[model samples]
Target: MRFIFLFTLISVSFLGFYNCKKQNDLIEQKIVDSLFYTQAEKSIIFSADSTTPFTCLSALDSQQLQILKKTSRNVKTNNDTTNYLVHRMYRTLFQNQGLTNLAAPEIGINRNIIIVQRLDKTGSPYELMINPKITQHSTSTTVYAETCITLPGAYPANVDRYNLIFVEYYDLQGVLHSEMIENQTAATVQHAMTHLGGGVLPLTIDPLAFTGQEIDSIMSDADSIPMRIFLTTIHSDSLILRKQSIDVRPDSNDLVLMTLIKRMRAALATTTGVGIAAPQVGINRNIIWVKRLDKTGKPFEVYLNPKIVMTSSNTILFNGDGCLSVPGVNGRTQRWAAVGIEYDLLDGTHHTEVVQGTSSTNFTAVIFQHEIDHLNGILFIDRIAKLLQTK
Candidate 1:
């Protein structure tokens, strides 16, 4: 009788311990699931493929849902779906007028969870990774999660942006998790994408600002400028070469803008020039292509609506200030040794950069001054003439 009682007690204890463990695991899983789903609902909703429509989670308010609906209609009208989606995504996600700019969505997982995924222009999915460390203290659980996008590219093409999300949840035990996903094929394709000149050039033009005839004229003029040719004073294109170019407004025709950029870059490549401006090709818009000697590899970059906002008191007389517009004239022009410029990229981001260096080492400052002068209807020879007059 004593042996039977002892065996029964042992069996009861083992069963109780096993049941307790299973219950605890169920509670922990409930906490994790609640946190992950709730956080994902609060985050930006992304479509896995182009055919999938953009959606909003229940966490979004009615106003946000309405905004998303309106944006969706606008996106549908655009022919270039990928580019339009990218533009609209940035605007809606970061700069929506009516929407509050919330922090990036946080996710807590004992293992790994897919927070969000996006399809690139080429229809390849971008993978996201989140690393979270969860700690439990008595009744509450705290989670620290960091998110990163594994860019589809090789070394150096890979870019890391951190601290995008943070997660917290309660009633869960301590758990640590980390995961990494890499795609070399995607990365290589993405790396190639960076070389494709510009980003998100809007196609629609403001009809109110451009009459039908004027639009046709501008388009024709832009198309007439061949990729291999530079409009020069030697070719009787003096009116355009000497005119002060207008600002490239948000309402500017994107087709004209893109055509001018492509043709100007092509024309600059034919010469030994380090920079070329839109007026040099007879279009007369505030645009320039400059070789950034300051950057690694000396990549040629396009700047829209470039303006020199500040100049150093010190000046350097560049010995050979030549131009593609004024071909036969090369003169010593006084240029600022360092200059601060306010310019816009093709992606609509404004940047104020201060470039400084001598004629030999970093010639970027001189390049800025020269190209901006073209936009202002001034040439290197004109600058030399002014210097002579002052002397």
Candidate 2:
């Protein structure tokens, strides 16, 4: 009787622990569902042929990494899904399964890292170890505008911004009231998302702003006066509109390209930029220079003659549109808001054109207009619908 009673107590304790864990998971899921900006779904790692999502960060701990590595070893003898770590695996991957076969493949990638598994769902792999860091404050408040949320929902993509800025971004879809934050608001939002996405916090700026209520004093700076350092003109072999060139004479074309590259890097540097045009330098040439996204931000691609095949009715006005060729001057110009440009990516061997799209918001549009205008001997000032009319 005593033995039976002891066994009964042990079983009950085990069941209780499991049941409590299951309940906690459910509650956490519900909170994430209700709160995160994007919907929750299972994610897989980079290169395995499986579709099971690594539902949460806790599921992707270091033990999982060890399991995946072992499984990778197991699959080396027979299957295609067995080995390798690739880009897609770096995030929790999501896809459909069961289409391939009854027996599952043995290896896979999880969390942008590698993995090994006996079966997709079974076995414990070690997680890549992670720890939180506390950084010293550079600014009393780091400014940012929230563009995405992990708590599945909609949010704004673009907002007025400047680094070391105080600004606000909206998410009316969640948190019934628009979240108001500053300093480390971006930090908090990103931190919360780590659990939602099964990843470590990618350091970033704060996405919230302080109104008069939140901040007693906020600074506003004046725009720099415009200057024309590069005496450039938009001259065209106008009719064909095939190509325009900017005679980069004052500085070596190489130096010219280098300087522009530096300015772009210091201001807005993203891999999204493909090339900068000659008209951008104030000479209308069918000339274009491009640099591919690399470990470094340099324009590596160049096009001597380029063409545009399609256009958009959307018109945009970039508030900070200024010219590298023209110094210190920026004003509003009206141009086709977006264009699907066709040009060669600088292989020098292949001549192909695609509908490269542009919008009014970015310096990209300004750059394109600057280059193409040089093709026609035009400058941003000539297209200027509004120059800062002096008082």
Best by TM-score: 1
CA RMSD of each candidate after superposition: 17.0, 21.7
lDDT by residue for model 2 over 173-205, one digit each (tens)?
111122222333334333332322433223222
Clash count list over all predictions: 3, 69
Error of 2 at 35 (Å): 99
Best by lDDT: 1
Candidate 2 has an lDDT of 0.34
Global lDDT scores for all candidate models: 0.51, 0.34
**Residue 193 shift from truth in candidate 2, angstroms:** 77
Name the lDDT of candidate 1.
0.51
The TM-score of predicted model 2 comes to 0.27
On the 0 to 100 scale, the lDDT of residue 97 in model 1 is 33
The TM-score obtained by model 1 is 0.44
